[model samples]
Target: MSGHKRFWKAVSVAQENGLFEPRLDGRPIRLPQGKVLAVRSSALAEAIAGEWGQIAEGASFTPDSLPLTRMAGTMIERIAPDPQTTRDMLLGFGVDDGLCYCADGINPVAEQVFAWLSGYGIHPSVTDGLMPVVQPEGYLEAVGQLLATQGDLDLAVLGVLAQATGSLLLSLAVVGGAVSLVDAVLWANNDEKSQLATWGQDDELVRTMENREKDILDAGMFLTLGRQVSI
Candidate 1:
């Protein structure tokens, strides 16, 4: 089966089990829901790797032409490149200015990441609870919300969404937390029906989810920032 179809199948399963009604940021997302999203996304990531590879292929600009942070800086600047041949090279992954690109909502790193992913055809927006929530512009707040509710099943749904949208990086953020949350739930699912059982098992689940909280924080600090910070 095609990648897109497979992705949709995943979503269908998730939804059938009451998992999701995909949402891109705030608006409802109905196209290419699951595995298809993952395949296209992988294709996009490979494409980005290819484009960067080509750029660094034969050219080696000196410190003047290429500063210490050359790659990171140039990549950041190219968030909105001049239209031309390279446009196709990126395959439409990028931002087109947010609600107010220059206003309080404008964040260069977040915008660049958003644009880059969108360029590859992944649409990202705010998601809260069971709805595709839309945040103002900051990436941290939205991500925090998803992570905050890790045990609520939203994280898994969001993971499926991230997989579909081809945001593996972001998926990492959600999945890392969601997996533990799901595991905790499964553990609780095994407990008895009595109050004592609920207290013991439910508390264990909360503790498990809480312990992994740092994973989400780490993701926020590193993944949300991107490759520059690592350097």
Candidate 2:
């Protein structure tokens, strides 16, 4: 029975010290670069195994197919191995933090956006775009402080989302207790929404929103399961 399965039929957790790892057929799984896929968070490790378990249901072995597992491997192989690059890349998202943009006309999300900014004392400037006049040092510093307390795997997850989305605000809000990533992305996309309102919603716009929504959802889900990342 198990012999017919395309992937490992036996999925398990390896508990040691105070961490957990996924074991396939009683052997620990390794990344493509041969690094063991251990994690400080039991929940995260099990979630990674679940991604692998799906291969048993079907027969594809692409990294994209196993995004979460790929996330673990990425954390171990790429992000973890280079902390300076990772930090630089993560912090680099602030150069165009989503909150900096504003709609020339009526941006529905402006109130919500400014409300979040009020607490941070950022005011808008009107020159090139209706943007936050202030630079993002304060916001980036706050995110850096929170990131300073996380594990590599969690940092990798947030990094993937942050870099992909190009907004440290979303990463920091989702990682910390500031706001939900969904609301954050929605606010970020307010300019897009304004464009759609003026130009009308089309297939291309819909697909763009779909992809962004997926990224935001993925980041939020990872953070939800990753409470121990902060611990």
Top TM-score prediction, candidate number: 2
List, residue by residue over 82-167, the lDDT tens digit for candidate 2: 76677767776765666455435424444454455455554433234644445644655654555566666567667767755666
Estimate, for each residue in 1-231, the C-alpha lDDT of model 1 and write its tens digit: 121111111111112222222222223233221221111122222322332233333354332231112222232233223222232222222122122122234344334445544433334553323433443464443434324434312222333323233333334333443323333222222223244454655666555444344333332322222322211
> Which parts of model 2 are misplaced by more than 4 Å?
1-5, 56-58, 104-154, 191-201, 229-231
lDDT of 1: 0.31
For candidate 1, give the lDDT of residue 142: 40
Candidate 2 collision pairs: none
Residue 31, model 1: lDDT of: 22
**Error in Å for residue 17 of model 2:** 4.1
